[model samples]
Target chain A: MNDTLMTDESRLRREHHKGHYDRETVYRILDENPFCHLAFVQQGQPVVIPTMQWRVGDMVYWHGSSKSRIAHGSDSAKVCLTASRIDGLVLARSAFEHTVNFESVVVIGEAQRFEDTAQKTALLESFFDHLFPGRWDALRAMTASELKATAVMGLPLHSASAKIRRGPPNEPEEDRATPVWGGVLPIAMQFGKPLPDEFNQMPEPGYLARLRTKP
Target chain B: MNDTLMTDESRLRREHHKGHYDRETVYRILDENPFCHLAFVQQGQPVVIPTMQWRVGDMVYWHGSSKSRIAHGSDSAKVCLTASRIDGLVLARSAFEHTVNFESVVVIGEAQRFEDTAQKTALLESFFDHLFPGRWDALRAMTASELKATAVMGLPLHSASAKIRRGPPNEPEEDRATPVWGGVLPIAMQFGKPLPDEFNQMPEPGYLARLRTKP
Candidate 1:
């Protein structure tokens, strides 16, 4: 595999030192974050929709209602899919130097709809397994009609790049001696206690234990 | 104020019940979330960039490097700004019924740049006060050159809609008897303990106490 996945559109113009084109860096960001914002041109106007996304090998997939405008507009259309995670808030002595520590990946490609029912079913199963291993087999099987009502689309990672910022704030040389309190306040997404549905009769499964231990 | 702010493009087609066009609901979502994704068309290609956003009255503002591609492409151009927060993960007996509990606001409008220095300065100060009250004054003043290097843009909330989903998953009646464990896993963004810079000699400010007590 190539060391970098750089394309004309994926190149970073500003703060170029933070730009990363390695597959490992890009895939790591995609895998760590389950949510993404998908951008596509609709009716000659730009539209963006937030959706849950997962990766399978070199392709990233997201599902939506078959009848959704997102499904119709993105089918076989060029798109920009971005996954971002805010790691922390960097506070400097000066507001000008204050910034957020984050990891983000931008992938540009043409979205391809998966029309094969069997393939779609397997992919959906993997989505569940990716988030919660062993939970998919424990649940009821997906109905044929249910599969037909969902649209699954995938975008290859051919043109992908990652941008990351981390650590303490970068203070200006002259302001380094300022007495102002400055540092990093970490930000994280955490899972609270799981509340069982009112109708649920089963005890919590083992797969859910991971959520409690996850950082 | 009008009861709703619905335009042809802002109306939701599928799951119309989840759509909210009222200003109160729309404004609440924008105010609660500090980050947003801005989408715009650049040379006929759709592009999405994640940035920090703040809402002041009927307008939402974001800043970026003046020389960045996002600034150049979105200047006086139609753009879509979306602020989303995932409340929880809804789990159902069947994968088909799985969904996320979230509050999202999508605002479509032309991004207008703020060229006046005084106006930009006030807006930038408000941005800090909105996120961390009284912290702006504690920090060093922003330099003239720094202000010139940044671009501040605002979009009116004229064409805005909020979509919210909450509570347990809606499972089919027939599948209610399934023995699979199902429920909602709550998700929240939290602030960790503040880590002061290595060179800092000042104690933490009172403004940071709010972060510790905030939910």
Candidate 2:
């Protein structure tokens, strides 16, 4: 992992030493989160784009419109990306001590735009398949013009770092005497009843079955 | 509701639309999400920070280290924040068409640092009550040094926009003739069993109880 991407901001410091960096830990966190906030500077100002992302080994891929202003110039510009998931809320005794337990990955690198049609198509296929195992095979082939209108960019994960904080809050030895109630108020994501599209003729996909059954 | 915030992004171009400025729809999505990616430019370079956030009325408060490098000029910095939640994964007949249904809020604003002690204390209290109710009174008060060392910033929700995409993929009518299977692979977030802190000596809070029983 690149040490440059790691910075110690006093307020959000790595607590419990669990929020440190390592390539293995970083990759796992990145894989778990499907969407990432891709940030870059445009016209000397900060711009953030929310998009779906897929990881292949040590590289991350994201697609954009051919006319996207930022996407067109990403090949030469510096980029910073952040992906996160709040697993639980750490409700400690003191209001000042309260914090949310989360896992987040940050990647800093220069993006390389993929220009080859075959390579872009392959990457796009993997991006879809990574989220839905067999969905890519169900669509019609991309037309030449359609292919020309889409762009894909790849950024290596070597300069990435993972920061995570889990469990309870950090209470001072002096404040431990307080009689306030304290414990973890875990956060969770739930899928509501599926609303099928007007055009969908069949039931949900099999992969969804596997996901729902997962503990 | 600011009409200027509703600019025409190519993906979410809604022309001559009214009632798109309600705060409930905008704030609900903002308050529901626990984490946000904050992007800013430092020395002509892009930087991203993932931090916990709370929405109170029309303002969002986020706190971090007073000594951190990212917030070096936050008082005068133009920041862009993006918050998102992935609801479900769309499994299309073709891999290229598979997509994820999601809700996102994007804000571009000038961050104003809160140096006043009273305002900072109030913001911190809101942050406390939002994270956990009835607990702020239970904990000890913050020390003068602690309050001084921490930096609190507020960005009004005036300049913001929310975007969402749901349901199944939109395929060409002619593609139905092809023999590819297509459906949605639903995605969801579900709460797991609460893991109490190893050092906890008191009972769990009531807020957590509701979280455990809710859908």
Off by over 4 Å in 2: A1-21, A73-76, A190-205, A213-215, B1-4, B7-24, B73-76, B177-181, B199-201, B212-215
Predicted model with the maximum TM-score: 1
User: What lDDT tens digits, residue by residue, belong to model 2 across residues B163-184?
Assistant: 7776777676665555554545
**Per-residue lDDT for A11-79 in model 1, tens only?**
888899899998988988999899899988777667788998999988999999999876785423888
Candidate 1 vs. true structure, TM-score: 0.97
lDDT of each: 0.86, 0.69
Steric clash pairs (candidate 1) = none
Write the residue-wise lDDT of candidate 1 on B42-79 in tens digits.
Answer: 76667888898999988999998999866785423788
TM-score list, all predictions: 0.97, 0.85
Question: For model 1 chain A, where is the 10-residue window of minimal lDDT?
Answer: A69-78
